[model samples]
Target: MNKSNRRKFIGTAAAVIAVGTAASAMPLSTGKENYPVLHHVFFWLKNPDSKADRDQLVQGVKTLKKIPSIQQLHVGITADTEKRDVVDSSWGVSELLFFKDLAGQAIYQTHPIHLEFIEKYSHLWSKVVVYDIIEA
Candidate 1:
C-alpha cells in the first residue's frame, strides 16, 4: 500500500478505537443511587390458575407488609408500558424489599416473617425465579 493508503487506514482505526473506548467508559444508569452494595432480589411467577392461588398471593403480600425487616414491599401485575422495545413490563406479581446493608439482607432472608411469606406463596404459583445483585 502507498503512504496515503497507510495514513487513511491508521486514521480510520484510531477513530474506531476512540469511539469504542468512549462507549466503554460511559456507565449506564440504574435509575437509583449507586450504592456501594445493592441487593436486587427479583421473583417471576406463572399466571395464577384459581381463586385460591390469587387469594394466597394476596395473603403473602399482606404478610410481607407486616414484616419490619422488609423496608419496602410491592405486589402487583406489570403495568402497560408505551416503550415496549426498551422495557419489560409484564409479570404476575413482584415484591421489593430494601435493607440497610448486606447484613440486613441476610437477616431478611432468614427472618421469620420472610419464612412465613415463602410458606404462604410458594404453593400459589407454578414457577418462581429470584435474582440478587450486589454492585459497587
Candidate 2:
C-alpha cells in the first residue's frame, strides 16, 4: 500500500474510533420513560368476516386514547401472515394500551369514555379477552 493512502486510512479509522468512544461515554437518551403496565385486549368480532365491523371496533378503540391515564395506545386487526401454532390470529381486532402504573390503568377502566365505548360498541365483539401485565 502507498504510504499516503495508508496514512489517510489510519486517520479516518482513528477519527471514527474516537467519535464512537465519545458517543459511548455520553448518555444515548436525555431521559427514559417507563411504562410498567401493559393492557392487551383481543376482540373477536361477531362478524369476523365483515370489514365494517372490524373498522368500527378499531375506531372505537382509537377513541380510548382520549383517556388521560393511557400513556400509549395501539389498535389493529389481525396480521396476515403465515400460520403458526403460537400465533393466535383469530381475533378480529386488538388494542394494546400502555400505562405508567396500575393506578393509571384503573382510572382508564372506569373512565367515562371507556364506559361509553363499551355501551356503544360492545355488541360488535362477541368475545373479548384481556391480558394485563406488570413488569417486576
Candidate 3:
C-alpha cells in the first residue's frame, strides 16, 4: 500500500482499539457489590420443555421477592444458542438471587417464604445445581 493508505489504515485500527478499550472500561450492570453474596440456581425439570413446569418455576421464583433480605431476584429460561462443547443447555430454568451479605443469605435460606417456595416447587425439577459467590 502507499504511505498515505498505510497511515489511514493505522489510524483506523487505533481508533477501533480506543473505542473497544473505552467500552470495556465502562461499568457493567452485573449488579455485584462489595461483599454481596450471589446465589445462582439452575434447575433441569423432569419435563424440560413443559410450559406448565416453566411457568410454575417462574411463579415460585417471584414469590421469593417477599423476603426482605433478598436484594434482587432474576428468573430466566435457557437461551437459544448454537450448540457448543462447553455450553450446558440441559437446564430449563435459572434463578439468580442477590443478598446484601452472608447474614442476609443465611436468613434467606431459612425464611418461611423460601421454605414454602421449595416445598411447593421442588417436585418440578429433577436436577438442581446451586452456586454461591461472594464478591471480594
The regions of model 2 sitting more than 4 angstroms off are: 1-27, 30-32
RMSD of each: 12.5, 3.9, 8.1
Better of 1 and 3 by lDDT: 3
Specify the highest-lDDT model's number: 2
Between the candidate structures 2 and 3, which one is better when assessed by TM-score? 2
- TM-score of predicted structure 2: 0.78
Following a full C-alpha superposition, what root-mean-square deviation does model 3 have from the true structure? 8.1
Clashing pairs in 2: none
Ranking by lDDT: 2, 3, 1
| lDDT scores in order | 0.64, 0.95, 0.92
* Best of the two (2, 3) by lDDT: 2
Lowest summed lDDT window (length 10), candidate 2: 26-35
Task: Report backbone clashes per prediction.
Answer: 0, 0, 0
Residue pairs with backbone atoms closer than 3 Å in model 3 (clashes)? none
Off by over 4 Å in 1: 1-43, 49-52, 83-86
Q: What is the TM-score of each candidate against the true structure?
A: 0.55, 0.78, 0.74
Q: How far off is model 2, as Cα RMSD?
A: 3.9
